[model samples]
Target: MKNTLLLLFSLFFYTMSLNAQFQKATAPVADKKEHWRNIHDDKVLDNYYWMYDYFGKGPDSTKVVDYLKAENAYLDATMSETKAFQTDLFTEMKARIKEKDESVPVFKNGYYYYSRTEDGKQYYKYCRKKGTLDAKEEILLDVDQLAEGHSYYAATGFEVSEDNKLMAYGVDLVSRRQYIIYVKNLETGEILKDAILNTEGDPCWANDNKTIFYTSKNPVTLLSEKIQRHTLGTEPSTDVLVYEEKDKSNYIGVGKSKNNKYIFIVSNATMSSEWRMIDASKPNDSFRMFQPRMKDVLYDVTPLADKFLIRTNKDGAKNFKLMECPLGKTEAANWKEVIPVRKDVLLQGVEEFKDFIVINERKDGLVKLRIRSLKDKAEHYLDFGEPAYAANFGANPEYNSTNLRYSYTSLTTPSSVYDYQMVTKVKTLKKQQEVLGGYNSTDYVTERLYATAKDGTKVPISLVYKKGIKKDGNAPLLLYGYGSYGASMDASFTSTRLSLLNRGFVYAIAHIRGGQEMGRQWYEDGKLMKKINTFTDFIDCGKFLVAEKYTSTKHLYAMGGSAGGLLMGAVANMAPDLWHGIIAQVPFVDVVNTMLDESIPLTTNEFDEWGNPKNKDAYFYMKSYSPYENVEKKKYPNMLVTTGLHDSQVQYFEPSKWVAKLRDMKTDQNILLLHTNMEYGHGGASGRFDYLKDVALNFAFLFTLEGISK
Candidate 1:
């Protein structure tokens, strides 16, 4: 009887231990809600005094107002101090890296170039070469002046004629609904003609240089149609209907051949694509579709003189293989493998010259430029051992045959432009950029950690901090991620993040599923019906951080924007206890509603990524985790939700409705701030300084929650 009593006592102890673990994971939600309420109430009183002091009148204002302002200022100062203290503590524990490098890449040119400003401004800068690796800039056009009448000045590709007489560039003024093909005189820099075209098209230079070929929407169905031979001085001509995409699934575009005999137009509907050959000799000739018999083929085809190089996944491998086929005779059976797929490597693009073809490939996360001899099939690889993410190789305009330039960059590294000689295989560094002051990469380190998810899947988490940091639970941890659309969240340097790091916070990237980090299969597994894996993986990462004592739940903050915002929404809803605060910018929270309506823009195109909600199973799956639909009566953490009024992708209404729903359903009176930019598109904060301010506010909120200063 005594032994039995001892056995019962052992069982009771085990159950208590499990319960304690559960409570430890969930105790932060109540504490966070209480803290947020206190902060919000105090801030309200502080804001009242600040407003009264700024606008109040009379001679006695100096006396009473000064006292009130001083008291208010004290509170504000205390909040700021609290944030700083928390930041410093995190910095001490995590060894935060917040150094900026002076050497980076800058655009060097003499002409005024139009580019997008951080504050959603269409600004033009006159680029002048100062010396080798140095350039001067002057403002040419201000977006604020032009942004009044027009929504935005979206700049696309620009092309100048061989004689430098005329220049042409494409611009999508608003939401890609109206595209304008603008032609300009190079000498005067005045727009000669701004021809409006349908959505989904790019301008292609004709052989005659005076005329251009492009595609646009059909007036009847408003579907994509091909238009050719539109000259500068002629009247509006009839569009040659190359390929009519019946369903909304197909995409159409025109490509000019090197020989200029046949115009290659591709039609892609769903995952499969068909190349149609159009006879340039006869403008009215019918287009014949060249269908290839390959399963799961994904490619972008570029034409050469005699043969066309196809950048595609024709082989049963993860990477793309370059296949060579004769022009106008490219069929499934006619394709000959020119470059075989290497393990853990992908060939990106190919640029052909007279005797050789230059192929860009990524091996072991590093980019290499390979030259393949067309005559002897010999391959020569150029070794550029840098953490380069994306690269573009261009032949010099002065000596197109001899000199080539390649531009590359990584996360921590700025862009570098190098000029290479094909014959000599020697590279000359042309330019390096200087970003800003007070940043150094050597002071910090970036490391990858794998954590087990709810399903035992290993999720890769990237941590960036100062060296020799202790594994303490006191650090203010900011975890960021975007897990969707097979997009890999590559490591890249950011100047704005230095402010948070310097304040003593631990920054992390959780590479959950729905991204292409592990491979294509990883993305496929996480998307569609398996989308719950993304939220679970992120939660697992948070749990692992707490379990390892890297950070506590009370000091952890989560962030995501755009599609990543969707990630933020899901995770916040699933495990609000694990996060002190969340920042969701332009999130797609109404997934079931958005995907169900085919009338919405780009809805059909995304059906492959997120399954069609018409099916009952898909509807159930999407509705189950939809953030807007799943706001149960529960205490939510402090959240800052932002969106742009001009955002075309995830419309502002989604966030507006989401904030409303969250406010209605939330039990705790937590601060749910919704900041909407009136002029910006999907990206908020148009200016660099404005962006910095927004980031500072976000960090300030997180720091306040950690009780750093107070």
Candidate 2:
């Protein structure tokens, strides 16, 4: 009898502990408030629209907070089994980082400027040395100290005056990207009383150290609306409004020429651009129009000693071209071709120097640097020797220097900095990323493959995996994509991704349309009326991977954030059986609703990318593919959707509302989870290590689904 009682007690305690660890908690059921949106002769009923009421402090604000908290609680309970695994993953990933790291110093204006991170610190210290690298270091700003108390803090736009006596920087405590400008007396180590609020972070200093030009943003919409000039130690309210952009769709910014001879205010939209310039010596002078905005044409101006270089898509140059215009005759008609547009090559941009120009061009989805001597027009392309890599011009602030600093990296290689002697054609590697716990590029293999799209267009896919992984259709693969805004999703190195690669996971990046990987035309085909192409292209890539025996449908996963999150949602709906799991971070899933609401941040600015839904044709087209709108009583892949409460780019309500609808409509019992960071914004945690926690959770989710605990 005693043995029987002891056995029963042991069993009872074991059951209790298991229940406590993984509780069968009920998922939060959001209250459905009837909300009807009628537009373009179409009416739609939204049940979770109350989520949008949080920012406005409406009656449902408390409900919104409560629902998000409840969802977080549910996620915690559901992922309880992986709590220890998550901590282990975080520590493992963090261990690979070199805690004490410093960036390569770049020479500019008699000072070598660089940033260094201390051990265990989440931010960096901006510093510079006068004359030489061995000179006593002058710490301009200690961001780790500045970000000490705030839960979310960002510092940007560090600019030093010509004399280097003063430094100006921008700070944002709220994480909304609305930065306040502050000046510091570098000699005295005192922060000035000048605080310019609600301005874009970058401050362009005039030749006169006291005057600074900045772009002021609208408080509500957070759009760059006006260029304002501020005199240090003066009241911000009394700052002079240098220029106000009347076009709501255009974004405006203020910048100074690299030679420190001109100050410019540039206004640009999706398809058009205009520039205004004034002499940097004359801060109070009116800016002259360098060029007027034109429809369907985009141009950028780069100043040189004798003339200005114009990079434009004028005359239907879909791949863009470089032209030269005399300083006095700054007009479209006066521009003459310097680098003619090529059918195969896309002239991305040009870096101007005293006697040479380095042209950034792309062909066949790879970057090529073309160096040309300004005196003799002798040009040569630099050899990178990599099949798939990203190389771009790094800080070449000194226009007279023959050495150009650039960064290079690939899917399997660590990011490396190099100084290329443009005249001698010599390249010297300065610094490479230190992946602490020892890493070798030869331990991995990277391949560039092409997948045929529905329209027969070839989409590039960059894949990296452990050296021994076989294409046996049994290994798991995580394919990522972000096909929007002509942003090329290049294959770059991330030390943290080794955690996945080592676990027999094949990681790949689908360079689908909507990105400029192939060229500008690739982006054009994936946006607006052709927006459906982006979705189809992603599906085709996944299908190709499965067809090629890289992975089976049961072990394939997909991940994307923001606009890419929209891609996740679209794929989950369009091809539900293709992916075993999906992770959408702060996804823009509510397309028609978000685009129709002009009051939302970035809505007006995205009119060209996502057509204005007020139009009848665009509304129906976007509605047809909108993730939230197309939610049906069907099975969806296991999903983990994340969002930030104060997300300014893609509002938190989007993902919140999306998860609620999926919970209500999705038929599968697959694990569907939402994790909302109540204190942060669209960018998640602001710390260097804090963001890794999020990554750990994501990785843990993937691992748990694969039945791998550690």
Candidate 3:
């Protein structure tokens, strides 16, 4: 009897211990179905490959959704302590925003167009007034009504007819970016029955005002391949296909010239571009090729009074230059230099007026606009006061107007619109965003600094902090980056970011490689086999900031989305101890898998950006740094991974699989969360105020790690 009692006691204690462990479980251990993939004599065993099952389609999708749900629940339960704090943060952030606001009205054609938000509305009400600003407003569409029944909503590509009676718009509710074009009679206030399905959302209005041209995408790959012509009130099924881009690697788009003289069909690849032109006055006419596609030559045509201006990289002009050719004689040999190529400056684009032309250029990773007189070819640049700022052309629909409308912003200033007279050089500030609850730009300090990379490249960093914040090493710092597609990360002000700054946090933007911050060569040096530089540059920036006493590893945090999320993952594996916490939004971590699958969106067109995995060398190189394949038994930072079920660009599975892999391998006990928004996409929440909820949740995660309850 004594032996039996002893055995029973031992069993009961064992059961109690198991229950305790279960109650304190940190994360779900994903089941492993290890699958072998051998490419170019290299091999990988993907354990969570089954997680790629389509969200709601396949038989295994239920398992996938359940697993994701469990992760969300785990995140919720773990962070339950911060729920109240999250609400407070959201409230504070929203309070700083002006509830009732209207955008600066832009005069175009015969009307002044603008959008306004009501005190409690989730979407904008698009309106316009004819003849004068004092005229009665014509509400074209109340977007909130269109967005009422959908969990996700977007209304874009609003183009008013030349006669100013009808407006064409595109609507997307699924978040997959497949938009349906709809036309409305602005004068009659009637929503037309005509609809065009599955377009790229941008439609070009012909001079006749009765027809529009739009590009369509392939169903599987989602590549814009065909341009179709649609006449108002006609069946979309009977629309004419104007042009088709036969090459899968090339993308096609249609637009009207600024002067509305020509409708252009632009076909562009990684290294080349071709333009087709048709007279806007003749909607029934076929397009004629302006210049045949050439290897290593990319150019865009802008129709001027009697000639066409071309921005081209011809004759080894890595940083493009401006060239001009007679309208009827647009051959390679007929091209004449208008603005000669400068090695140190990148000529971004040109905006033409009747008497002058505004050149958008970048120098030292900063944007400036140069106005040149068309009569005498004299030029001057617009003077922006700050060290790091962005100034670019806004809506200038009138080709003959002397006043140029542009937007300017910096790390310390709110977004401001200005009208600059090209001849007088007078800049009139039209409007500056209003930050409610008594905000002041003077309370912030902005600085521009550089971090040297391993290869002697100086990467720029933009820093902004609240006044009176110490530069001590103990201050918390948030480093943000996104370096891909030659997209530059500008130093723009954000009212939401004030939350972090007010909390004594320093925010820095690392203008790493893979971005065109320093021009084309900068982007070239960070792609393909040299792609590792992007990761190294970010890592070096973090280390340099720490060495400079900006912040230490204890309080350092990193954030990025999409391609930059890939950067976060690589750095986490390469330097796990460097960050205390990391936030990855809609990360594209499964590079090798996604690139190998041609059916995926953006894969076929981005072969030059990220090498084709079919090639032996490319496969091995990509496999070397692909985040999911690189995760090993290591200690990682506290991480919050977010994704949207309807994401069109970076599929939710990439991040889902990555988090599962990290959870299974990482040895750290730090928090790991996965928040899948079932209704949103690559860009988070659609509504202006609802998106702050995400920012609040992220802030709450960081605060929770620091034991901050407020």
Candidate 4:
């Protein structure tokens, strides 16, 4: 016992020595400007606004790049002490993955399609077999070959023609989300001469198979604003503009119906949607409007036998409901209710087939699939035994089949895919993701808990930890939250997270407002003017857990990315002393400024999700909560901020300027580091295993603060 105490004492001294050495190195400094602006009779100063460079290679980009490089160097110098440990973490996490695994084949038309990863490849190979999975594998496109010479690569909108002879795909070589559409003659193994640039990545195929409808992005704002028609043999410059969205706030998209009977163009904003339909057989015919756009009336059209199924939010159905209309009369007044809305149920979406209809609904913050037999109209819900889990429809391309494919997972369960007979109600497990190393689902435990907010509202929290770990406040905990855009962060299992659980770390997600966890009202109560509730809810969750002996402030850590990154920034400012460290990834910190600038990608389209800062009330309200605008000269916890230079969603300038200002005004000597990925964008690295390197880096930062460095 004496020797053990001496060993721990010696290790603590060594760690302290490393911290002292790191603190001596000079931190990167940024030049500040006295730029003042007036808005709604208010004056504000933005010192680091000079970092705004959309292209990342503008005339002033040199200084911007240099400052970023210096920050990267400082991070390297400070984190150098954990270089070996980070590498080991990366290797450890990567080993849990099955390197040569293949996804379960999804059957479409005459082929069974799937993607396979090679033992050492960085990208996947899309392959298919005709008739059955036992047939010879036919490679559609080797993404590994396409990504060979690029630093970043992503392929999207992978769709096959109705005839199964052509593959339409989109590629983005630079980590920006701008994808260029391409068509390949699969039989000849040759890419065609057609190439359309800057698309939203979803291609709609006409029944003729030679004509395609795709949405194009605006050059300046990067919003999907135009729908274009391209024939297989036509010149790229001669593509016809079929439709265009004049409203800047509306995003446009095109899709083929599930039955491949009709093509559609949908224009949607936050609370409104308008759809136009085209007969699939007549490729040259113009599309006709199914419904006119109405404010606060959202709906989606699904092609049915003699009528159209519309999932709409009309008639005060805040949680949405299903309605039907004649094929020739799709106007709102002519619609008939197919499924009534329930206050406690959130009707997410629907999948139509000749023999069955699947409704995806959320209740009590959990997802379930309701399968109804079209013949007898008998409905049944799939049972997931866990208190919290995710279940939804998989790719069921055929409209005449009785077998339904679905996926299910939870915090402790591996992703499992099954094919169930809707009529017989028999389910067969097709595949479950394999973890290479020895793993057991029963080894960990997940629980559902609620934390009461200041307003007396109960916020749900999903927690997972190693089995048999004592809830004694001594264990380190990582809390995560992202509450924006009505996006629900479901309880999904991940193999990489096992690394933390095995090392005595508890992970929890605070499902706060601004997400659709508890239905439409949950999201309604936490956005725009009520955005503070999302942040405060997360804070309350942390306080509740600590008070309950789950963890204390000394060992608590916070993490989030993008809008959630905004959450991290808010919590840090609101309760700086509550966390030992915080990691913000590609955070949208400059909310007020970013919203005021309409040229940015998020400004025009998300004006409803966020408010239009041009309004005086919104200007002052957002100004009060914007993270970058509210940074004060006070002590803060250790922070590690990361962003990519080529980010298309939240610009790199946001986080870059944020960290610079924090360094200038922060009073604490606590370690603050910024990492700028020069080769990636908003989503980070494109390689299969390369993104794990960042995860390992983040874990290393947390482990170091807890003095767990090896």
lDDT of 3 by residue, 535-626 (tens): 99999999999999999997899999999999999889888899988999899899999999888787888888889999988888888889
In model 4, the worst 10-residue window by lDDT is 15-24
Query: Which of the numbered candidates is closest to the native, going by highest lDDT?
Result: 2
> Candidate 1's C-alpha lDDT?
0.62
Could you tell me the lDDT of residue 164 within candidate 4? 94
Model 2, 57-118: lDDT tens per residue? 78899989999999999999888878998999999999998989999998899999999999
Off by over 4 Å in 1: 1-122, 126-151, 172-177, 197-201, 215-229, 234-243, 255-264, 277-295, 315-318, 341-343, 351-404, 420-423, 467-469, 685-697, 706-710
Cα RMSD for predicted model 4: 3.3
List TM-scores for all candidates, in order.
0.74, 0.97, 0.95, 0.97
CA lDDT, every model vs. true structure: 0.62, 0.91, 0.88, 0.89
Question: Local error of candidate 3 at 181, Å?
Answer: 0.2
TM-score of 1: 0.74
